[model samples]
Target: MFKVEAIADSYDQRVVDVDTGVYLEWLVTGSRYTTEVFNLVHPGGMIPFTTSREYGVDPHTGLPFLVFRFITFGSAVRAQLRTKHLINCTFTDDLAKKFWMTVAAEALVVFGSAYNGFKVPNRRYTRVEVNEKIYTLEDFGYTTSPG
Candidate 1:
């Protein structure tokens, strides 16, 4: 008899305010791992606010920023490492067209993999690619990195 392993992961949800074609406060709930990483990922795909004080205005850009702090437990691992992927549907006109093409291609990849009965990792998602560039919250205007 062969044994198979099943790994279980947790998920959480938060509320994100959409206005000014940017991002505002976000309600977050999840494991420390998921929450912290999600915060660092920047919900709106933009950078967080940064300031001299905990919450000060940036002199250079004149945009209010925030300095975030988060501490994680278990194995002394760093709490707020950002992920390098942007999962969005918006793009420049040129990029948008290419993005849709990539989406089609990626969908085909997923369908083909599924058709072939390939075993994909449980949490792993195969999605569209964009310019090999990682998207951040700063691109859309998100302040406050998660810890």
Candidate 2:
């Protein structure tokens, strides 16, 4: 419910193309392209946190999650929050960013790398060919070395 409303309210509206021509001496223009899909079902926005539930203590043990097993308009929900995926934080849809990031870090660890700040990677990303392009890590952003 909240997810539907949220995406409708906020989405990606990008300009694909601008077509301009003279139609009957009148200028006709239009834009083309595609679409907002935000993983914006955040901690508190969609699913309620501990403070949002009936009581501070979670009705369902462990982390909270959205229940999509059954969709019932008037059905009674035992617990406002679901803790099914608490063991591993897989409740949200995300790219393999975490896993890939760890792999990238391994490169830095073995070869060693520097940081911009105390322990911050560089602002720019590093684009390199890996495994003969079969397993390339494109635009490895947040690099430690500038040059």
Candidate 3:
């Protein structure tokens, strides 16, 4: 049996747009990986954005999966945190834990690429439970450069 639980932690950063300052917090969760971006500086909640994905069964492997999803949204109204985006990818059970962990790191790099000035710290945890015996593992860095 192949059963694992993964959690993507959240991070916050303070960004300024010329004169106005805003706080941005990004939260990611779910077995399939769902990301939520919020603008704490503004009174209103989540900002609106466009989401698109390319997902289906691989023609060669014949396995169902989501290749990637792109989220494009505007940053704070006045802050320089403009044009923030996230690229989310799904890893299937066939892939090893290390492979998925590397993929997660790549996703983080892509998400923070726009805001090079700011830093975003991310973490991934994989947990396995069998017959009430639980094992927890964490991956902070990738063995190979996710490039």
- Among these predicted structures, which one has the highest lDDT? 3
Q: Number of clashes in model 2?
A: 5
Decoy 3 TM-score against native: 0.23
* Candidate 3 residue-wise lDDT, 1-147, digit = tens: 111112236243323222322233333322344433333223323332222233345466565433223243433222224534422222245344333333332333223322321122321122222223322213333332232
Of the candidates shown, which would achieve the greatest TM-score relative to the real structure?
3
Error of 3 at 80 (Å): 14
lDDT of 2 by residue, 8-106 (tens): 354522111112210010011112201101111122222211101011222554432211111111111322223232111222343443332333222
Residue 103, candidate 3: Cα error in Å is: 10
Ranking by TM-score: 3, 1, 2
Worst 10 residues of 2 by lDDT: 21-30
Q: Provide the RMSD of all predictions against the true structure, rounded to 1 decimal.
A: 19.0, 20.9, 16.6
Which is the winner by TM-score between candidate 1 and candidate 3?
Answer: 3
**All candidates' lDDT scores?**
0.27, 0.20, 0.30
Evaluate model 2: give its TM-score: 0.15
Which candidate order results from sorting by lDDT in descending order? 3, 1, 2
